[model samples]
Target: MIVAIKYPNGQPYHDSTHQPLSKKAADSKPVQHGHRGMSLEQELNRANEFYLQRGIANIHKKPTPIQIVHVDYPKRAAAKITEAYFQQASTTDYNGIYQGHYLDFDAKETNSPTAFPLNNLHQHQVTHLLDTKRLGGISFLIIRFTKYQETYCVPIDAINQFWERRKTERQSIPYQAIVQHGVLIQPSLYPSLPYLEAVDHII
Candidate 1:
């Protein structure tokens, strides 16, 4: 079967293949232990589900808009997406209503223990968040530092401050600064990462 995927700008997607490590090599590698058992997205999804079930908030991940170019049907009952293209660049990871205010945010994770790379966010996304904030909506970022197993709800103001500083100084936001300005979201059993608890502080 052949499959092709392209970005909205018409650039073809390239899948980078990685070789699997042998058993011995995999076992030999040092594993960093942390309380987080799931990725940032998964944790948030679980949290959103919890919120939804309890009638707390109606938050959800935004689905990427895509156009199917081709479909392959080898059997009558089996069909495969053979070709597709993204309709446009996504604005954010998630958006919905919470506590009578519109919520818009993106989930981001960094391996770096000291800082978050500014380049991780695109200009379009920044613009979208800023625009949302200007219109009296809640806009923020959910950032996770894998090494520390810590997640934070960083407000748009903090992002704007560091974003402007990047042009004149460093290319990343210092971990300490984020810790000072952002609210730490603790992981829980039912909701997983209880980020809205942090959002409560933000609003």
Candidate 2:
């Protein structure tokens, strides 16, 4: 059964379907130095679980509230959601506490190799991060460049700097600027993406 999901603004959400690559085709692809198969969100979820098991941190992806509008009952014991809409715009992707400090952050992926477009982030998200920081909480972003398979933990201050400059300057933050201002998170086996090490720097 197919499900129709939409945003609060009535825009339909397009869910991209992925086909598994053949073993021969997968072998032909160039080796990625970083985590290749899993998305940034998946890696983070795995890492968060690891942290929870180790008592290292308590972080989780914020669940977007959905308002179900339609449901189909194909069987007496089964019901499938046919249509749903987001209850409201989300504040950020992930949030929780880390080592006595409140941590709030969002994860974003860009296919571009040269820059991270400011348009990728919404104004409300930026405001939320700033507000979190103002309340003495650690707020930041985990940006992954798909082309390079590189991820960086960028502090909110760095993001705000470029966000303010976009009014009269370039609309996107240069990759070099991210490399300078953000800490590169190296992938690991246990937690997969060890972003907390980068967070340690921010703290």
Per-candidate Cα lDDT values, in order, are 0.82, 0.85
Per-candidate alpha-carbon RMSD to the true structure = 9.9, 8.3
> Which prediction has the highest lDDT against the true structure?
2
Please, what are the lDDT tens digits per residue for candidate 2 over residues 1-203? 77767566555565432222334644485345445588888788867876776688999898888999999876533466789997866588899989999999999999999999999998989999999999999999999988988899999999999999898999999999999999999876545698999999989
Candidate 2 stretches with Cα past 4 Å from truth are 1-34, 71-80
Q: What digit string (tens of lDDT, one per residue) describes model 1 on residues 98-168?
A: 99999999989999999999999888888899999999999999989889888999998998899988989
Q: Show where candidate 1 strays beyond 4 Å.
A: 1-35, 72-79, 86-88
Error of 2 at 126 (Å): 0.3
TM-score for candidate 1, please give it: 0.78
